[model samples]
Target: MLAPPSASPRSVPGLRVPGPRTEPAPGRGARAAYWARLLPLLAALACATRLPSFRWPLWSPDEGYLAVQARMLADGGELYETVVDRKPPLVPWLYAGAFTLFGDDSLLPLKLLALAAQLLTAVLLVSLARRRWGDGAGRTAGVLYLLISVGLNPEDAQAATFEVFMLPCTAAAMWCADRRRWGAAGAAVACAFLAKQTGGAVLLPVGWLLWRGGAARRDTGRLACGLGLPVLAAALLTTPTGFLFWTVTGSGAYASFTGSELHVLVRGLINAALLAAACAGILPPVVRVLRIARTGAAELWLWLASSVAAVLLGFHFFGHYYLQLMPPLALLGAAALQILPRERTVRALVASGCACAVFLAWGLLAPRPELAHATRLAQAVRADTGPRDRVLFWGMHPETYWLADRPPASRYLTAGLLTNYSGGRDGPQVGEKYAVEGAWPVFRREMRRDPPAVVVDDSRGKPFAPDRVPSLRRILSVGYAPVARVEGAVVYVRVGR
Candidate 1:
């Protein structure tokens, strides 16, 4: 068995820590028996915690937008051109695969994909912790991951967001780094990056470990080769200009600071508080790291720090961004608990379980304003239009498109292009400062080419009235008229249809 550096096992009476520093590996039968019991329990826990997601029609507009793009891709549309988003290609492709495998309307397949990723991440943490500490610590780490993963804001916790998918790859990279498998670590890092750009931060700690361990030249060379393979494959699958524009150039504008200092500060403070409250069960381990365990577990500390950088990468501080920190925190907390008395360990486990249960209940019972409105809008659209007809939503509600089973008329699904309304930021900025140049012209061109059968204005006139947009107003006046009002949204149908 392995243990924390320079720390001997304490002779605690009831604590179940590692026996010795360098024991022989466990027998294959013992390993199999351990997994045979643990895997089922972890699966059950994951299912129980994620139960609320299946009840929701949509988690958030982000996933809804991704689903819409995925649907378009399934119908032979190209990404970053015919259908565009600032996210990388892998997640969209995953969603597309889910749509293909289990009809576009079935969300169960997508939910299963996310659950598999979460479970795989927990299993990897178990393996890593078991190797470093002991079986008890390993089990604790896996359980803790499942518990805290759902102890978050409902949208983030229930939705299969990019963070949820990227975690397994991120944890795998860390596990490879711990085992000194530099090349495999690099490969896993690449996969994580393909899932989300924030995953690139995994390189920081991996590089630190490599240099600190004084790796051989061949090891570094192999790592570079592993990192390049997946990127090369991605390049072949996508147009260079399209990929760069959406993932880099377009994202740069989204990341730019547009809100007031006070507003940003307050949002950051609120998110910080939320993270603390949700993950409070793991606080003791964090405190231990800050006070005493830093030098002994420096790599874990580096991992935690790098994750913080990734979480705050775009400076948006959304709840899902905090998922990046959970893996390392779980491992560190498990290691800390390994030496604690049985009473303390039990107390921590109970607290984590309670947090998970409370959050799960809240997420299940919470009323999502967007989901209700989108459902109404979708019902109206379906009643008014055929299944094959194109519908355009002129607001932040991309979920309407997915819900109605209608294809979007433009690459820009939401009004972000026209309104310059960046989510997780302050307001719909004035004067189109943050808006993409030529996006409006593109939207106009697409509308002319496709000419949606129905157009839904869901903005509710808070930021701007649809009639206030001269181009849209002219188009509607020429060819369309309002047919129904569903909730606050006005549904319009083409004249003479």
Candidate 2:
């Protein structure tokens, strides 16, 4: 995570606590006031770190799905029926609720909520790490979290911010387990699970804690009731449609765990390794921050990386999918912050790591200048689009939907320009098989249907193909004609004739 840029004076004299080793404090009361002021300061800093230039960094195509689902829910779909997917009702449900309450999601209020939640996430991680380690470690870990966390785009961050709220509850419960608050910990674990699948992983961490602490089975059982039962209840109550979606449709899209594809495993491991190398580079600074967990920080790396491997290799490898691993990495980094030696070598390593992290993140995340033309065309569509117009795009740029202020539904997925919606039974293997078949006739028929379609496409990345371009051509050839070409992006109008 990126360290929220500090607006407060840097290196304040009496406020800087250097872990348990520092004995230069004047009085406990003064220190208490110091800390009291500091917490809000950190909170403000965290909020600011995430709030930079929030005019929309870059929108992912998937964001439209979220926007669409949220819009549908706000329009008054009930419970399970409201959310389109079965993965979990938590995030989409939250978006729906937010949209319903606000009535319009385009304004500042929704943006503020996302920003607030992200800041809260940073603060919570710092507090939990501090409780386990010390001020020094927490501060260091907090900075690292701030650094790495900035890697995600504003929209991506906003989409997953719901889980940030749940992470702290789980972390707090685990922190409690360190003190033998078994029942409380169990309940916390359950709550997190109810929040997201990552929450379910808390059970592993907590169960490990129970075994490590030598707690009795009866105690563990009590904790599970408090923590786990509600998750099960939430799952059951929200079943039927949500569950059915998962079993039938969602499985086709998700199932990362059961995925037999070779890249599934490779991608997961590569992501984990990148994370591991990242943590190792920052270990020295983190060691100086938290003195309490001096020995355990290394162990944390293993557990954290293992968890990342589990998630990355599982249902999907979407960049935001790595979020669950962030908290632990932050904690370990915080613990390491308390024990750094002031040697030149250590400082140099930390600085180098910081530089590498920034560059890598920039390369991975920086806006492709090429996307500008596509965005410009999106502006055109936004201006010309009539109220009833359902804008359709058949290109790499799905985010254009959000910028165009259109309801997301069929806007992003121009698949119909390329396939048959009424084609198959939606079995587990159907989507892959269909794509493999790479037939264009299905799409021609879909485009030929009632609503009429406006298709947008560009071939910058491949100009030929990246994810699937052979198909890109077939669609480009039959149903679409070039309407506008900005930079490298070509917007085509789908004339069903």
Candidate 3:
């Protein structure tokens, strides 16, 4: 009788039986919706942290120097010839393009561009983490990245500097690698390198990933081609000699250690402290990665190690230099949060977010006497000079050139070359014993070719007074006289109009 009952359905021909219906858990659907909204919220947080930059006309010395260089480049000046800097060509050209679109003296557009890049970077981090972990981990990574990036000094975090621009490209390369798009990853790495030399460090992790993935011969060739394309384009646009020297050879001297042992030790200690403070926002998750989630963290650790090498390469340890560490740390931190209890994860993220807010507030409240002094000096220069008049700044306040809206009389934007005042080193006096070789002769030639209508001595006699330079004193005595003394700078004007 039992067999006959079973046969009723089993023996039926051309009949299909349906399985039990399955439904997605309510919690899963809610999480999906939460993650979808969380991404844009993270982007909004990024903009909120960077909003202060909108009010700042100038954010850092690097931005100021690059702005002047960008102006020159936009005005048809050649890199390393008509204008000079130790940075690669891409960032300056980017600035030139921005200036072309928005006009010069527009800091708003620059801030917006940097903010866009930051948001793109956060999105890319989300994609990378989500692929490896899950949606929750991805959101955590994005939030941590936004917070950790701005968790440093605003002078570095807010400025549209090379590091800021480089971050997106760096993050893109990692994401492309995770997807096994070797050629695109290589191109992204090259783009990052063009933004900043430190960006090249990404090649280590990317190359290792490619090798580990057992990429084919064509894949390797494609990557090689992608890496060479940007460099080739840059070389074609500018002279190969100029591009190589300024971006590579000339930068060598700048990167060399030029301080004594004690100075090195002191700077090392200070930078270590800075590194700790800069990383404190992500400490809990960083610890989690080191302790619990280490098995699958090899790639992230490699990424972090390479970034650390890049940040420590020049030994300068500028606040912005720490930005290179944020992406990998954020990804690792996200994995750490993935293994945590829901309550603890929320608390950790909240603590990290509050830390970022505190840093942003500090940056806003920090006194910027240098910027104030430059503003007063620029006002004085503008009042004393004509529309067509060219001005020369004797010190490192390159911002004055842009603020004054006057053309630079010489190719040297700042006198760091002539004065040998390497940043983060002992001071200008440390290298005074040795001349920069042909620096003075080149300065003399350039000045003779196009004499400035006004020369502002912004060097407040730290290493040497303005009169201490024999050539500068001679130039001032000949056709220039002190017209105004605003703040610590002395503005000299050409006599009798």
Give the winner by TM-score.
1
Candidate 3 shows a clash count of 0
How does candidate 3 fare on TM-score?
0.88
What lDDT tens digits, residue by residue, belong to model 2 across residues 288-391?
A: 44333224443355447555654644444554566667777677655543444435224534663474455345445556453465568778767656655666
lDDT of 1 by residue, 144-195 (tens): 9898888678898789878899899989998998888988998999899888
Tell me the spans in candidate 3 whose CA falls farther than 4 Å from its real position: 1-36, 260-275, 288-293, 427-438, 495-497
TM-score of each: 0.92, 0.67, 0.88
Residue-level lDDT of model 3, residues 204-299, one tens digit each, is 888888888897898888888888898889877888887777777765445666554466556556655654565565676566434533335677
**Stretches of candidate 2 exceeding 4 Å from the true structure:** 1-34, 53-59, 78-83, 102-111, 151-170, 179-191, 214-218, 227-241, 247-249, 252-281, 284-303, 315-317, 337-374, 395-398, 408-497
What are the lDDT figures for the candidates, one per model? 0.80, 0.53, 0.77
> Each model's number of backbone clashes?
1, 36, 0
Model 1 TM: 0.92
Best by lDDT: 1
Show model 1 residue runs off by greater than 4 Å. 1-20, 260-264, 424-433, 467-470
467: Cα error in model 1, Å:
5.2
